[model samples]
Target chain A: MDEPLLRIVDVWKSYEDLQVLKGVSFELAERDVKVIFGPSGSGKSTLLRCINMLNPPDSGEIYLRGDNITAPNVDLNAIRTRIGMVFQHFNLFAHLKAIDNVSIGLRRVKGLEKQEARRKALEALNRVRLAEWADHYPAQLSGGQQQRVGIARALAMEPDVILFDEPTSALDPELIGEVLQAMLDIAKAGTTMVVVTHEMGFARAVASEMIFLDDGVVIERGTPEHFSVSPKSKRVKRFLNQLDVLYGSHEKLLKLSEEEEGK
Target chain B: MLFQTELEFIGMGIVNSIIIFPISIYIMRWYSKKKDMPHIQLWDTSLKTAYKVSLVWLMVNILIGILFNTFAKNITIYFLIQYYVYMIIDLFIGTIVVKSIYKKELGESFMFVFIIQVILFGIGLIIGFITVLLLGYIFPEVSDVFFFVLEFGLFFTLLITASSLLIGFAIGISLAIMRVYGGKELHWLSSGYEKLFRGIPLLVLIFIFAFGFPGLFWYLESLDRLLASVIMALGLRSGAYQSQIFRGAILSVNPGQMEAARSVGMNKIQAFRHVVLPQALRLAVPGWSNEYAVVIKDSSFASAIGTFEMTFIAYIWGLRSVELFTLSMGVVAVLYFLFTFPVTRLFGERQTKKLKKLGMGGG
Candidate 1:
């Protein structure tokens, strides 16, 4: 029971000629919030995909509550139900409306009755402030609204951990705020999360532990304050320097990135 | 029965069918209007619509019949003229009415109604043929009762095509899934089936089932089994072509949809059923409609093996007057065109409209 809720042990995955993730490993504790940020092509998204075995690691193991999930004998679907994921592209089922998108897994995977599943779906949408748009299709909504519906869909599963892979990367600038705000509320509610994003403000505010992933490896891990002030790696310091310009609005993150780069 | 000869009976059938057409339409229309019979009423709507189309078509056929009767002297020429005339009306008038019946936004749930009507019409035609045959039997058998054979032969064309299309659709969808998502072995199996069925001619395949296979299998020698064999062979061959249509539709669904479904904890099969196939099937409607047109065309070859569909009956009728064979064939080609063109265009139009709502109308 004292063990972390989710653990990835030396996971590695390569697609054809591209090695997406190289020997990445981490542990996520219950009720803890994590935000991973890195440059493009840094394997941040691949690591998140590997966590749910959507792109299963070519080697090594993933354990959920001490069960080896990467084993061939394990049911990937059952394991996935315990750990939900949100993609960069808000891939909602077009044929179904927003509510049914949230309720489908509830009916098919959870075996819930129609009314119960629908009620739960509406409740999940309510959390994202999308209950009013329940009957609308994904095409009818904006990018931010669609991403919020995506979060609600994952949240409806009530998984042990939810992974967000650049969830706001595809949203319009104005829409990113709403999606991030919904995510911030989820973090405040103490749900476990692993989010990959460049939104340093969200990370600074809600992240309990932040990690810099680069070259398919975890370059640095610390509190947002600790990472901002003094990241040990020169590469991480340099990346944080660029983030300094990205997060110029945040005085603390700017001062830290500047101070560390100056050092 | 009042006709002096078989040729006169042919003439009388046109007159009687024209008269019976409106009376049948009236009764069917009144029955459809009855309250509190939802199941019957549901079917009655399509049937009434069909009756209206047939009524218009019958009038046209009568006009052509009257024109031809002034020049006709034999049963063979009468049979060929009447068949060609009816087929033309069915293609033009029937197609338009059926298309109009489906003009509203149709949910996938209503697909069963469309399919059931085809099956029911096949059954209706058979029942009507049997009724005519019984009426003739109860009376005396005149030597020139060739009109009965002609009617049965014409109706049999529709029956075989309907059955083969239904079977081919089922087989084609399965083959498509196998090709798209199945493993290496299953993929090879489906590919092999498609290649084998599509490569050779439909006539060759039909002959294999009707004549070649029956020699090896004792049960296939039976008359019913022989009929089943012919239908199955046509359907199997059609399935190969149908598979390509389905595969194209399945591929048109974006790869991201599958990933989205998986991210939500649905397995491959559930994801396909929930996310992929529903969308793919809608997109496939145009292709599937073309497959139906092809089934009618290809199944006409079933006549070579004595399956007794349109092409074979046309050939036999043409043979009766050898000098007019070329003229008969030219008319048959026109008849084929009317039956296929309009209905397929309607399918493409409706599907395009539905797909436009989904924002995928360009392709």
Candidate 2:
């Protein structure tokens, strides 16, 4: 097998006395889409942040393309450039317009010239269908449009993988679909992603693998089909059912997954 | 001319004592009333009110008489002796009157008399100061003094205020960053510096910089020592205050701002410079203007060290006589107000509107 594009080994993290992640391990091959879901405090977001060292894991190692990012003296900023992040709050730089927001990293970190960065930023905006909203400040944009700009910001970096930490969680219900659609387009383009969300329909449509985290440990890991059809753990089945009821009908979720699989 | 000066002094002294006597007693009565003292009948007996009035009257006359003899030209030793004899007589009567009126012990009545004397002097100076300004308008000779103060004094004041504000703002930004984002040692050091400077009076600091340091290190002496010391003292004090302003503005920014910047692959310093600092500065504009006003007023303290700023110039020209002193102070006060008001309005109101337009949060 070709070496996994990213690997997490025995990751453990704690905040003071409370352990947030316990011996969680995972791997992602190139162009893989992993969907992570659990109760709010299950450390799914923590794990994603650890991958980029935003919140460094207390004990364990993370490797990106076989480089040990967890080791001392590793350049974390350089590592972060290759691992994009989309926050739940859609943390767009409030001072900059959408175009500048997407272009800042490209110009600052990537050493791209002004025109080149602008062109690439526009291209990324177009990808997220936010090209016309490029000149608007984050405050002027709707919640959905802001999230799309956030995604474009991450995508412009051409990172190996993007981590979406509940991207649609802060959006109004009507606005969630547009952002999810943008994420779907990115997934279809074969960009590697790890998304932490409870949107069962989106998970059903694009997840290459599904992970269920509880009490800071992975309770279930399987193919998308394994989760919908015959998850081994009873807790996994119960969680999917709950998520399905909250997000949509199980039949509808299954139908979406089947149609995407066929495609 | 010498006889006229003495008579003028005596006349002004009588007028001041008459005006101050009633007001001081009324103020003292109001204060004692606030302290929940029992309503003593102040006017029931003719003797007590007469005593209170005369006690204040005699004190002001004696004090102003001595000032006149010392400051006015060609006042003979005979008049000085006459004022002393009256002061001794007044002191004897003042204690008896205060004790009988307030029904207080000897020490407390002495304190009461002292308090009334200070109030009389303060009020007397203010009235004299304004009278000189009025006299300047009527008399052509006095306006020359006003223009002299405006020309020579205004320049040094502007120099002190501007340079100190610049130095302070720069140091303030550095110190604020250290207090906010720096690690254990830096945070401690910056905070300690702020506490030490803010706690020490600016006058004491000026003295330290001007005399103490140069005395300890002879090589530190320079021709511009007084001016430099004034700037150093004012700048360092302003820096302590401005640091707090900037620190507050920095913290007012959403923490998510720094996190977002870092997530974009910029290091902490880059993130602070690009994302946090701009927003913090915009929020700091109002506070920065307030610091400007405070530093401008504080520039007056430079007069103590004899930098030729307006107040120092005021003192020099003022020393020719008491009337000149009053006129010089009035001019200095007006000039300081003029320097501070317009700039504060420009920054405080207009920049705030601009910040609002940009959608930057916080006042």
Candidate 3:
């Protein structure tokens, strides 16, 4: 009933023979951490990409704070600048250094001066605890470091909402924690984000609302406690069984499950 | 049995060849190493290192022939045949040595080096026949035009290669973008332009421009149509190839890169300019250098249109003394090789270093 920062309605997308996304819809409120999870071929990444018009939904109306961004002749670049995306591959420009990777869009798209962009980029990098690696190229950095750089790049945009397309998926098992920590810090800062990830701990801790998407449809969407305790759909209950192993039945997760059960 | 004279001749030539190698390859490596050469990144492996070893072998043989006059005491038919036979054996042995040392990357191109050797030997045979078998029949006036054409010819050949490559490279890059990223009409236009220019021979193009087009312009008598037509015809043909080089280079850039840039809010063109083109240009270096060699070689066809370039100079010298035609052509080919070989090798080295800096191997 409250106003939403970003809203999508009945999106459909097909690539040649593949109907990658069906009638999908969602909404993001300001300062909301909405975590979406699904198995492979669930179209989670495609849906995130569509929100920023990177994939440009074949049929859907996307409204940003009330203005319809999906209209035929909208300024896609302006709309995109307000919606940052972090990729699964961490798509940091290989040729540019970490700081430059964060600063370039500020300079180019945001029309910030060199010093201003550098300051903001450094601030963002510091936010991710990667200020020291500012001069290092993406290729020179490790997987987790690169993913942190990717997050810093997104944060530098200061977009209305950030889209995380499995940002930690490419990191080594040991490396995923640092990226998650950086992401958790960003989430605590109250930047609206729509994350598509398998990190169930992140969802339980940071996500105000959690969703289960399967075959491009939202099977379940609720507060983390509600979703965990009841998980209305049978598919979700079955899917939650597989995910608990991935979520690592650690102490924090065990505590979370207990809290949700009590709720 | 190797004679002291033949051995000394080649041995001094080897020393000379050593000096020449640095001048050609090192300078080239230094000059070309900085540019974003498309896929010209060479793997700095022992296999590719053999390119230097084998080049040394090939150059020494050419040097032996050039310095042959000092060892020209016996000019019998059997002697010339024996010298060629031994030279062939040395080249073959050199190939084996290179093979034994490394064979991964160099093996395929090593065959091309062998084919060049065969072509060189064929040229040597023709030169031998003209100078030794038909020496008495050659007119003395042939020497009169030799120094003049050789001096002026080298200068103009360099000028033509520089001008044509500069113009072609610029135009080719534009055309490549059109074919790669342009709308349907521009894509069709670029492809059509590439096909039209590439399908027609440079000789035919020069003739069309030089003989056919000069009638339209009033001030043509003052301008150097020979130079103009040679550059225009060759430059246009080169643009077609350059476009392909750039197109391939642009394609080599990962698609994710453009998507990443676009996700950051830069439009299609900005994403291409910022993210894709830099990587693509690096990938294009090898292809760019090949196109460079092709342009220089094609510049030889300028002689057919009377451009007074090196080959045309060689043609004039040949006609002056018909028997010396192959000898004159050999002189031009040696110079052509001198000009072309270093450029390709230097640019090749630079590409590898650049690729390495980008955290990729000289692949």
State the lDDT of candidate 2 residue by residue for A1-263, as single tens digits.
Answer: 56799999999999999999999999998999999999878999899889889899999989899999999999999999999999999988888899999999989888899999999999999999999999998888999999999999999999999999999999999999999999999999999999999887888899999899998999999877888889998888888776775677678777767988999
**Runs in model 3 with CA error above 4 Å?**
A16-20, A246-263, B1-150, B216-218, B317-328, B359-363
Candidate with maximal TM-score: 3
**Worst 10-residue stretch by lDDT in candidate 2 chain A?**
A241-250
What are the Cα lDDT values of the candidates? 0.76, 0.81, 0.77
| TM-scores computed on chain B for all candidates | 0.59, 0.59, 0.59
* DockQ ranking, best first: 1, 3, 2
lDDT of 2 at A145: 97
lDDT of 3 by residue, B79-178 (tens): 5466667566767777776666554456555665566455545554455336533433574443334443445475556568868998998989999999
lDDT of 1 by residue, A178-207 (tens): 999999998888889999998888998989
How would you encode candidate 2's per-residue C-alpha lDDT over B106-193 as one tens digit per residue?
Answer: 5534544545554575577568657767776787555656556654565556568778988899989999999998999999999998
Q: What is the TM-score of each candidate against the true structure?
A: 0.71, 0.71, 0.72
Give the C-alpha miss distance for residue B95 in model 3, angstroms.
43
Worst 10 residues of 3 chain B by lDDT: B8-17
Candidate 1 vs candidate 3: the DockQ winner is 1
